[model samples]
Target: MVANPARRAAVTDAALELLGREGARAVTHRAVDAEARVPTGTCANYFRSRSDLLAGIAQRIFVLLAPNPDRLDELAELPVDDAGPAYAGYALERLLAHPNLARALVELRLEAPRSPEVAQPLTEFLRAGFDMDVEFHAARGLPGGREHVLRLHHLVNGIVLDALTIPLAPDIDPVTQAKDTARALGR
Candidate 1:
């Protein structure tokens, strides 16, 4: 079957919505087709199996959440002392902007352990993003090294997960929490 970029994107997006709203159990080819408002079998045409569909949602989440290059360039121009928190704030803002996307990602992460096919691509994509962040931090002479970057990733993951689900400190804004966490870790 000829691949339609728009249709594929729509299918993935619909899958994401399902994953976000109803968890992974609700995401199937037929459900995705209904959610995306596409013809039956359209999701299967784009994603051949359940694993393929889940993996596609994982990819689509990152693509949707990726930082803006122009903004990254702006953050890169900040002083080393200021850059980390600035980037953290920007990243949190982006994640907050798409709560469903973040939730979808959380869903995928949860599913990864049960399915090797899901785990492989998710791990690869996540590691690739982490490596890119480490490279960018090093190349820009940001305040942290690989370990610091790794720490920030762990911290941010917790922060985002908490903010999305049960907030430990609901009164404290997530963005503020992210910036503070980044600043402390950057040192």
Candidate 2:
């Protein structure tokens, strides 16, 4: 049978949108079929299982996170000043584009290993972050040792998740903090 790339793309996009809007729990082969306006059997035929679909989506997300060989270009060098902060803006943009996806990723990470199916993207994403943090540290002449930089990266990740979990501040602008952090880390 000939594969229709457009049909597959539509199903994938529809699944992503459903996952984004309703969280992972809402995604099902049937729901995806309905959302895509495709045959229910078609969803199963293409993806085989929900886990497969999730893994495919997760891989897509990782690609988006890094976005090619120039993923570093997403952010300016370590010392992105108040004038031009590419990474800060990019981070915020990513979060805004699909905060729900971020939340789903965090939630699913715990159980990802249970299924070898979903494990690949989860591991890839985790490993990629570690590599990025290392490069992020090295880019600044190792101002802080590996451990210190790793600690900072963890802190940033935690804070981003916390900010999403509970909105304690009604008007907290992350940009200012990002600038302050850049200055502090640059030193």
Candidate 3:
């Protein structure tokens, strides 16, 4: 079918917003069309099935979250000792900027195993971070490279989730914690 890129993006965005605000069940073609203020059948035309719609959301999530390639290259070129803190700062800034997108990601992950469309994006989304971490550490000659990156990933995920969803412990500072974790890993 002939496609209008802008329309497709709008539909995809509407689907994502629905997924973010109301969860997976709210992402039907009709709902997306309504949410996007498009004519009836618009989303259906763009997305042949629920799976297609989900895939679009997944792709959009990846695009929204993926770091800039130029920046990554620059980071790679930086002195090993300095790259880690820059990477950490970049991550924390993105997380803070898009809480809703992050929450939507958590929601999509919960649905990924049961939904085929979600599986690819979920895997790619996750692997992108893992691979980036490994590459950064490898470039910097950081010890425990992949393992340390993985640990930092888990740590940041937990801290972000907690800070976003629940009140933190009295002394727990998520930003400071993230910076500290990144500093430790970088060293």
Write down the TM-score of every candidate: 0.95, 0.72, 0.82
In candidate 1, what are the lDDT values of residues 12-102, reduced to their tens digit? 9989988888888899899999999999999988889999989887877888888999999888888888888888788778877888788
Sorted by TM-score, highest first, which candidate order results? 1, 3, 2
Higher-TM-score candidate of 1 and 3: 1
lDDT of 3 at 182: 78
Predicted structure with the largest lDDT when compared to the true one: 1
Error of 1 at 138 (Å): 0.5
Give all candidate RMSDs, comma-separated. Answer: 1.2, 3.8, 2.7
Q: Candidate 3 lDDT, tens digit per residue, 24-52?
A: 77778899999999999999998899998
Best by TM-score: 1
Off by over 4 Å in 1: none
The residue-level lDDT of candidate 1 at 17 comes to: 85
Reference-based lDDT, each prediction: 0.87, 0.63, 0.78
Mark the 10 consecutive residues where model 3 has the least summed lDDT: 78-87
Model 2 is weakest, by summed lDDT over 10 consecutive residues, at 76-85
Give the count of colliding residue pairs in each prediction: 0, 0, 0
